[model samples]
Target chain A: MTLKANEIKVGDTYSEEVCRNLSRTQIVQYAGASGDYNPVHTDQLYTSEIAGYPSVFAHGMLSMGMTGKMLTNYVGHGRLTSFGVRFTSQVFPGATLTATATVTGLREEGGENFVDLDVSTTDEDGTEVVKGTASARIDA
Target chain B: MAVDRFPIEAGHVMMFARSIGDADEIYYNEDYARSTEIGNIPAPPTFVQAGAQFDPDYFLRPRIGQEWFGSAKGPTGITQRSGSGGGSGGGGGGGGLHAEQHYVYHKQLKVGDVLSATTKPGKSWEKQGRRGGKLMFSESVTEYRDQAGELVVTATSVGVRTERPATSS
Candidate 1:
């Protein structure tokens, strides 16, 4: 169901626990699905010894993908007009993430109602991992 | 990356949605999607990134019969280093890292829509890092058009090449 423009005001927020204790297997699953099998995300020995990271980490896109779920669940199916994000920090295995979308503005254009959102996803330590904005169609 | 034929299939959509931890019925169940406002299984917002699967030359994926960079018997398979690992994370050898991604949806991307993508370089800039040395960032925009040649999605991606590996702080 689409969000009703009259029901939401600027500053309204929705949040979801996107993932908990992120696992290497889930990171590999994302790599397989997204076709970005970078060894830094899946190979432990390669990541530590070669890449010089403590361990395998999640793709920035994987964090963005999980955050998008919170947007679709808030806005409705097939309603997003635009979505963008910047990767702020690396997300490693065992980190829990929470995504939140805050309503920034609401307007009507060409007879279609729309809602603009400020999106942010943070790890268990409250460090922002992905940050950006999204706009979606809404019901008046 | 350019893809001549990127079919938005149901199984692929389901796998992508599941991988992202989304349980939305519209992403998987055909009958449920048929009743929704979208009227069909629609690709998740970030789904088009999967077009790399159709890109034959995507560097992140290990090509058959080629020496891969990841470890096999030792710390790495390749004997010679091409460049330094850079980017935010998930660096493929010395390739750039993904910094930002943006998408504008022209229409709902649904199952059965075969998309062709064409990418164009956007912009490039440099920045100084506190610990990772110099950061070189570049942008690329890809337009995904359906079989009928209608633009379905416009994706803009930014990649950063750090002078050295970015250590997690």
Candidate 2:
């Protein structure tokens, strides 16, 4: 869907919170697909014994990807101009995540419309995992 | 650093989508994707984070003596900090933490695309932390291009290495 710049309202949010549940297998698949084999994400024993975490945890990129899915679904693919995130907390197995994107800025630059989004993801307890912002150009 | 060219396959795209709990059919089924505006399976937005996996000489590979900040066991061996820590928090012989990530898309990445990437350290700075002492920050930018030499995606990630306070042993 193409977002019309004129139709966007600053401070107006789009969509409800999207949620997902974390699993170990998914983490391992991500490790394989992403080529990030750091044991903290795949090996429970290594995480607990070597890394000192209670269990293998999700990669920060995994959570960031989830947020990307949310924003892309809202704005459409290949239309994104910029996306970014700051990793805030560790996500462990079995953690449930919720994410949302809000329209923070809308304007016309060089005759093209753009929308600024404030994106955030939190666990079930409302603790922030990833906090970020994305800005995209709206196709005419 | 240079990331060797690698083909973007449909299966890997699908796997990455599922791994993130995204069940979108366009990322997997070519037939379904063909019906979409993209006309084929295009990777999810952050899919390029896996760009390192495309290269054999990715600098962040974990080794015995290489450490920047947090746990060496994390993907890319970059650490994640929880805001409260002594020197013990980000140890691993000086490993850096993954501070931030930014991506700018010029073109969509689709299946069957052979892509190569080049990464270089960008800006570097330092700032004091409340409890973690002085933090040294650096940015790395990776540009991905298709075989035809078109820019597909440009991803920039920041890392922070901590220096313990004088009080810490």
Candidate 3:
């Protein structure tokens, strides 16, 4: 589906309230599915005792997904072409994470419309958790 | 259950590609693959999972008592999945769902070149409830390197755990 100008415009922003905090059971489930089980995430003892983190943290990609959902929910379907992000900070369960995106670029070609968004996610204190850019093929 | 950072060879990619039945010329045909800008057979978008040790289903299904409602497909950016639920490589079903996945494109894996990937959860968190369900997010980072000590790829991914209200059917 193509996004109308009202759907997402440059400088447009949307904020979804943090609904659920992360947990070990979730990580273990992902590990079993994604084939990723590095102890740094699943083993609190390893993260605190061996890896040096106060507690097991969430995956950067996992956080990115939250950000991605924010963007996709706003833009709708069949309008996204490329999306990516970079991890800058660690996220622990129970923190209220706010995913935000700013529209930076937009254009339309013979047949396809292009919408570019600069995305940055932060925690309760405004810590940049993950920051990156995303490009979508919109209809507007 | 981190993706095994196994040394991937051309032969291995072929087998892996076959397992997914990608059947894309770029994944199997050398004569056709070399003709593209990628220069060689390329792995599918989901090929990153080649380094994994378990099926994608393990995370998609209800874990005994944990029944979560999710869309088959996630945000348009990138996606990754299932498998305590058993199936013979059935297509990773479609729904607007997003789970754990990380990608690090440090270098490209050319045809016949072997590479390995290692991954782990970087962090995790849970939210009370949104859209009538609780949400849990997990982040995992993946590192892909070759036997030659060269970094091939790096990715950090996230997952959303949203379980419907106990009263909802």
RMSD, every candidate, angstroms: 2.2, 6.2, 15.6
Choose 1 or 3, whichever is better by lDDT: 1
Docking class of 2: acceptable
Give the per-residue lDDT of model 1 (tens digit) for B53-133: 999999888899988888899977887656653223435474767899999999989999999999999999999988758
Worst 10 residues of 3 chain B by lDDT: B87-96
lDDT for residue B141 in candidate 3, whole number 0-100: 73
- Chain A TM-score of each candidate structure, as shown: 0.98, 0.93, 0.86
Tens-place lDDT digits, model 3, residues B21-122: 234465567887777656776544334554554333434333345433221232111122243422111111211124444343455556555555566777
List residue ranges in candidate 1 displaced over 4 A: B79-94
Tens digits of per-residue lDDT, candidate 3, A18-101, equal 325666665555444334444444556434443344666665545665565566556643245556765666677675677777
- TM-score, per-candidate, Cα-based: 0.96, 0.83, 0.48
Candidate 1 local Cα displacement, residue A2, angstroms? 0.9
Residue B158 miss distance in model 1 (angstroms): 0.5
Q: Candidate 2: global Cα-lDDT?
A: 0.75
Evaluated at residue B134, the lDDT of candidate 2 is 87
Report DockQ per prediction, comma-separated.
0.65, 0.42, 0.05
Sort by TM-score, top down from the best: 1, 2, 3
Residue A95 error, candidate 3, Å: 1.8
Query: What do the candidate models score in CA lDDT, each in turn?
Result: 0.91, 0.75, 0.54
